[model samples]
Target: MEAMMEQREGVALFTICRPEKRNAVNFVVMEALEGALSEAEADERVKIFAITGAGDEAFCSGGDLHEFGPLRGAEAKQMLTRMGEVLYRLLTFPKPTAALVNGAAMGGGCELATACDFRFVKEGSRIGFIQG
Candidate 1:
């Protein structure tokens, strides 16, 4: 799974599971994130939503350019639009949210962290926007 969801102690923890790619965002990760958010929103037991990466090396590196590099004009546009909608929903979510920044968070990863209500960054972790 590109992402996984675990609910415990009233928190729904959404983890991006592509450590090999530095937890980079791809279509699969996007879908999984969206689904996790939706599920947590509807589940009354979940009072908090938290997001993080699989490994300690990176919270997230941003988009997987290697996976998306082949897209043409319309395809790229559609993907970007969808991701934007997902972020918008997260930003407006009713419940409190948290971003667990375990390591490096760059580009879109930085955006994702900001979307949450609060961020808990690990010691020595770095967060920056490198989007161009």
Candidate 2:
């Protein structure tokens, strides 16, 4: 699994578990995030949703380029649409949402952070949108 979810004190924490890949978002990660959000939404006790990365090196660097670079035409569009829908869900989640940016947040990572209602960046962390 590329994502992990835990609940505590009415808060749901969703962590992207791919620090080795700079916590990049792949299809699996995207699906996991959607599932986690769905679970949290259905849980009445979950008053807030928080997202982060697993390691100190990066909160989320962006989409996994190596895995997605070969996609073209309809395939690429579909993937983008999928991710956009997931982010849209996060953006419109009923409860408050936060992005705990522990480190670098680039590209899609930045988009994810922006979708949240709140964003907390750690010291020395970097965030930007860089796509080619």
Candidate 3:
């Protein structure tokens, strides 16, 4: 699964499951995030929404360039636009949202964290926006 969602203790946890790619966001991951938000929003038991990445090496390194690097023109725009919509929803989510930055979070990963109401970065973790 590109991403996974679990509900526990009134929190809806969303995990980006792509450690080999540093938890980069691809089309599938984006869809997973959107779906997770929809699911959690409708669940009254879910009091908070939390997002994190798989493994300990990185929280998220941003876009999966290997998957999306080939795009141009309309294709690129559509992908970016979708991501923008997802992030905007996250930012405006009615319930409290948190970003569990378990490791390095770069580029779009950094943006993702910032979209939340709170960010809990792990000790010794790094956060940067180095992407162009």
Candidate 4:
């Protein structure tokens, strides 16, 4: 599973499950995030949405370069558009949203964190937007 969702005490916690990849967001992760976000948004019992990563090493490294580096024209555009929509949804989520950055959050991961209304970072955590 690329992602996991757990609801506890009216809080919806969504975790990126690719610890080996530093919880990078590939297409699979994006899709899983979308589904999880939709479900959380629709559930009236979910008072807050929180996003995090599986391991302590990183909250998210960024987009999976190996998976997305070879796109040409239209394919890249489509993917970007889709990701933009997802981010927009996150940014404008009806309920409160938060990014719990336990570690590094680079590139798209930084964007994800920023989309949330609140961000809670742990000690020694790093976050930035570095386009390559």
Candidate 5:
């Protein structure tokens, strides 16, 4: 599986479980995130959400370009639009969201973190607003 969900400390944690690719977000991963977000939001047990990566290397690398290879301009744009919609829903979720960046967060991953109400990163990790 590419993701996992857990609850603790009055918060629900959604982890990007792919550490080999630095926890990159593919379409499937995005869907999993959407589901996790929806499930937690609907469950009254969840008051806050903390998104993070599974390993020490990265919070997320970005979109999985390898998953959508060689798409033309229009195709890429449409796909990106879909991803945007997912993020928009997450951003507008009623409860507070946090990105517990244990490591690097880049591109769409960084946007995911920024969309949250709080961003708590480890001391040595880097955060970037890159897109690729």
Candidate 6:
């Protein structure tokens, strides 16, 4: 699985677990993340949220270029719009939200981190929008 969900001290931690792919962000991953966020928000036990990548290589490396070719312009637009909405939900999550950036955070990965209210980055890690 590219994503994993766990709870600790009322904090719902959603970890992207695709190290071989450098934690590349994909539509499916985004949807899974959104689902986890919604689930946490609705759960009475959850009071915080966190996001991180599995390995040390990357937090997320934007969208999967391999999957983008078949996506039409309209589909791409819709995907981006939906991603924005999901990010908005995360950004405005009622409780404290934090991003654990331990590695490269490119494009949507950086966007995802930026959406959170707080970010804790490891030393020597890259955190920014990369490759558009």
lDDT of 6: 0.87
lDDT of 6 by residue, 8-43 (tens): 889899999888888887777888998998899899
Model 4 per-residue lDDT at 55: 91
lDDT values of the candidates? 0.93, 0.95, 0.95, 0.94, 0.89, 0.87
TM-score result, candidate 6:
0.93
Worst 10 residues of 2 by lDDT: 123-132
Models 1 onward score TM values of 0.96, 0.97, 0.97, 0.96, 0.92, 0.93
Cα lDDT of candidate 2 equals 0.95
lDDT of 6 at 30: 84
Q: How many collisions per candidate?
A: 0, 0, 0, 0, 0, 0
Clashing pairs in 3: none
lDDT of 3 at 70: 96
Stronger candidate by lDDT (2 vs 5): 2
lDDT tens string, model 5, 4-83? 99999779999999999999998889999999988998989899988999899999988988986666799988878988
Off by over 4 Å in 5: 130-132
Clashes in predicted model 4: 0
lDDT of 3 by residue, 1-132 (tens): 889999999999999999999999999999999999999999999999999999998999999998789999999999889889999999999999999999999989998999999999999989988847
Per-residue lDDT of candidate 1, residues 1-132 (tens digit): 889999999999999999999999999999999999999999999999999999999999988999787888999999889889988888988999999999999988998999999999999999997647
lDDT of 5: 0.89
In candidate 2, what are the lDDT values of residues 11-98, reduced to their tens digit?
9999999999999999999999999999999999999999999999999998999988899999999998999899999999999999
